[model samples]
Target: GPQGPRHLRPLLDTVLDALHTGTHARGGPLPTGGPDTVTAAVHDAAGDLLPDRGDPDALRTLVHAFAAGAADPAHPLCAAHLHCPPLAVAAAADLAASALNPSLDSWDQAPAASALETLLTRTLARETGHTDGLVTTGGTEANQLALLLARETHGTVRLVHGANAHHSLPRAAWLLGLPDPVVVPAPAGTLDPVALDDALTRLPGPRGSVLVAATAGTTDTGLIDPLPDIAARCTAHGARLHIDAAYGGALLFSDHHRAKLTGLDAAHTITLDLHKLGWQPVPAGLLTVRDAHDLAALHHRTDYLNADDDTEAGLPDLLGRSLRTTRRPDVLKLAVTLKTLGRTGLGALVDQVCAHAREFADLVHDDPRFHLHDRPAISTVLFRPAHAPDPAVAAVRRHLLTTGRAVLGRARADGRLWLKATLLNPATRPDDLRALLTLVHRTHAEGPR
Candidate 1:
């Protein structure tokens, strides 16, 4: 089904048009839109058929059409997920990687690409003060790799974590062959050492104690767990402590927020994603382990492919250490972004984003119509209608999506919906969030449901 030799001009034109005309110059559109209208517009944009006539021009047209239909998270007002307004340098690197079409499974296929990945992985591990790690596609894969490593090395069954750990942790368990992983509850989205101890007592400890996952920054509430305390308890209980810092690990360079990750050195493993807080393009996540020998368990091999002895020749294959075989060179973009932006630039950006998040929380603190759920720990503000009952959360969410005002965040805990805003753009001004708050007020007042 491969299309043979085609001119690259059309593809180039398509990509450029999507980047320029399809995306928002500032912030993206609001999350909610009329489903009927959205689908109708997209249908009209296409050539009125599911299967297009195999024309290159038509395909290019389809590309722009799809881009136009998708929401642009790069927009300034897009504070929904842990999405960043990707750096221009990183975006260029991504385009280069796609052009190269390198498969990182072996050195013969990807020589320089493999070497670049190796250096980037090592650099990231060093950044985490660790000796070994791999570049995963994203945080979910990194977390899965971390869990698999723990299971293979420690040989335990039970996993413990704060109640507010990202959904990926439980999903990681499911993917790694442990369907019923233990979930240890901690109050206020922060882990209580005593609660973990009690959990240890209730569950058969030492036998099933596989891994203890701690959050440096939780996804929904942006609260950091008592990591040092959790690490200490993990050591006392002989459990491998893995810090899921995917959302907060970028703070390592930020002078303002580094204190939040004070005890990260004590963790056995750490996961950080450049695509999230680091403001790099997607498909870059680092899983750094404290020890190199511990990572040997995940080194898979097969006779079908010849292993490269490049480490001896000053070039090592990164493919062996990763969970993915036909992997994309996700590291190049990070390396380029880091080199171009420098540590200070990125640190300042992080500070700017967090400052805006704090400003948002403060702005909503006493607003009679809205309630600030918790303080902005890193770069997120959890808020909802102050007067609206907890039951109205779902209705409000549905209504927001129906009107296409903003792409807001939604979380459900104990049967209550909590709305969150994850700030990643340094250009997102306080006034922009203020406008969102105004939109929320207007939307709530006009609720006909």
Candidate 2:
């Protein structure tokens, strides 16, 4: 059923060409297209498809248009979020994975993919001082799973997290039917151990079950919670600790900044998103648990997929360890990426981004127009133009986005709106960052129009 390479060449070539045209030919990180316009364009493109006919050219054009209109994270000016430009090799591996379409639910469906995922999970676990883990769709799913495991281990418990924790934490609590989390103040954008201890103490009644969730790199300010101190406190209180390192897990690979995540190994569970700092494509989220037996909460028996007898017979299956029955073998691309770029290479990329963030922070500090919130712990710089109101900041962001000049991040922190720039692209240089800052200044000067 496999198509010969000769037969696939033209189609692959068309796709590659379309990608280059869309990404390179596009003037900026994004196109100046409103929702209505983009929606109409998408509708028109969809109309070209027919059940019985396939037009490669039409498909290529549509893909090119879609890509061209996309927010280009590879652009230096696209310092908005944790989105990182994917590595080319990983992208190619993703294509191969798509072609294979391996489902990881069972050994029969995945085979080598399941083995590779198990291997990768083990390797990642060892790196984080764990025994096993699983790949997830992203941080949200990983965090949710971590909470679920915590809930399974410790009954109806209060979830505790920092103010700058990802929005997913509360949502995960809601989904898990756990009470609203205890929100601790993160004045400096990182959790204060004393504040967290006080929060735990203030809890009503004896603390039967408590899951203290910590952030490794908060999305807004890139602050890492004092993991070692928090771990010690959690140990004292017999509370389970979950570190959401979705954005900052790359620090594990960084030779210079790995110490920032000093207590990562001590966490009962940790969430890592490769898409953010690992330079992989999207949906490269991983949840690593310190104890492999803890995964029993997610284990299940299915005669068709993972029967007890089959396991007893030495048959390997991954269904017992996953929430979804049918899932893509995303680990394939991750494996390819890891092999292509060793740990040191990836670490250097992370170091580069962090260094850039520090430099940007210094620049913001020296500039009279902006107020640097705090020294960046990772790759995010949060600051606001002097005397700029929230509306003005919003307008500047909108003006740049609409004009396709830049796409920056906007967040509300410490009772005021602030602009944020996430330096995830290792290729971005100091000049590029300065240019982005200049754009921000120009947009701010334009006022709220």
> Per-residue lDDT for 1-449 in model 2, tens only?
36656676888888888888877656798877556666776677667566477774785888788887788888999989999999999998998888888998888888899889999999988888889998999999999999999888777878999887999999999998999899998887788899999988777644438888999998888888889999999888777899999998889888898889899998889999999988888989999999998898888888999888888898886876689999988898898988878898888888899899999999999999898888888999988889988888888888888877898898778889999999899999889989988889988887767
**TM-score winner among the candidates?**
2
Residue-by-residue lDDT tens digits, candidate 1, 231-307: 77777766778899999999988888888888897888899988899878787788998988888886765634444
> How much is 175 displaced in model 2, in angstroms?
0.8
- TM-score, every prediction: 0.90, 0.95
Clashes of each: 10, 0
lDDT of 1: 0.77
Q: How far off is residue 331 in model 1, in Å?
A: 1.0
